[model samples]
Target: MFLNTWSLWEKEPDYNSYLGLAENLDEKGYAVSFGDNPFDDDKVGEKVYMHILNRADKYVHIITPYLILDDGLLMALKYFAERGIDTKLILPGIPDKKAVYALAETYFRTLLNSGVEIYLYTPGFVHAKVFVSDDKKAVVGTINLDYRSLYHHFESGTYLYGAKCITDIEADYQATLSKCEKVTYESIKKEKAFVKLRGRFMRLIAPLL
Candidate 1:
């Protein structure tokens, strides 16, 4: 059964609900959040990475128009691979911002090495901020992997457990996979350091950039 595609940000997830997932996971010894504000050091050694990793359920479907592999998210992804999670990352192939695209590549290499599959949505901007784990839970809204979306933007997302919506989200993620290029560690290491540095600089002001 295929569920029709719907816009993520346009759909908009409830703010409190997204944060609730974080708190709930924390109680269960997992910590993840929707927005940035990484002030809770003891609780959140990593940012919203638990949003991706703490799911030992089925699969993790992530849709972010823009993405970067910061330390927090990176560590969570590494953990996901160790546990053999069916990891799928869907990002934008036709990048609107050249610098951000470069930075994403840097993260792509790291993610690929950790056994996390990468997918790039080429139809458009692919700016849907959402994540679904094993069809049981899903988050969709405006959050991203960059520091800005996490630390700045007042983002929102949803966690749905229904059948119709879950199927559609999975289908879209799989569809985008067909359009993505598989990244490798070799390619990442071979990338130009100068370009990578430029991307990092951009990340420094990613919220405003």
Candidate 2:
């Protein structure tokens, strides 16, 4: 498995893309025992979604421009860390939107200190949403795991089987880390007043914004 062969999407947030995938999976059913919560409505069900994170025992890969991991997300990640699951985060060092990028630093700092690893990508904007667990399944598509993406705007990702595509995604993550800087709480403390203030503000509205 090149790591990426497991899952793939030709386009980002292709509506029919995820809908089609859901139909296929529905038809295919589960050869192995599985748990799924269909997102009929727009809002992301926090409890169920977070639970999935806590239960993932294999490998978990999440790709997004920003990682404002809620407490549940953090707890699940901590679980992954304690058990020594292969955990990696794909993040962007630079973002197309200046405001979000500035605030993202704080979230990055928090996660890095908490033991979740981060990888920054300097190449343009990264708008891919992908979460792959182990060599078995992956979700790739237009939705981001952020407040706006998950709740406000509609989003979708198709779960896939196999390993090659996933392997490639992992490889890309690793290669990105080499070009990226690792964040730490200590480093966060070294941030300028504006950055610090921005982080403070972001946290205040963290849940809704």
lDDT tens digits, residues 89-180, model 1?
A: 87786889878887677667667777888766656577777777776566565667666666644554444544356667777777777877
Model 1, runs deviating above 4 Å: 1-52, 185-194, 200-209
Deviation of model 2 at 132, angstroms: 2.4
Q: Pick the candidate with the highest lDDT.
A: 1
* Candidate 1 overall lDDT versus native: 0.61
Model 2 whole-model lDDT (C-alpha atoms) = 0.57
List lDDT for all candidates, in order: 0.61, 0.57
Give the RMSD in angstroms, all C-alphas superposed, for model 2.
Answer: 8.4
In model 2, how many backbone clashes occur?
17
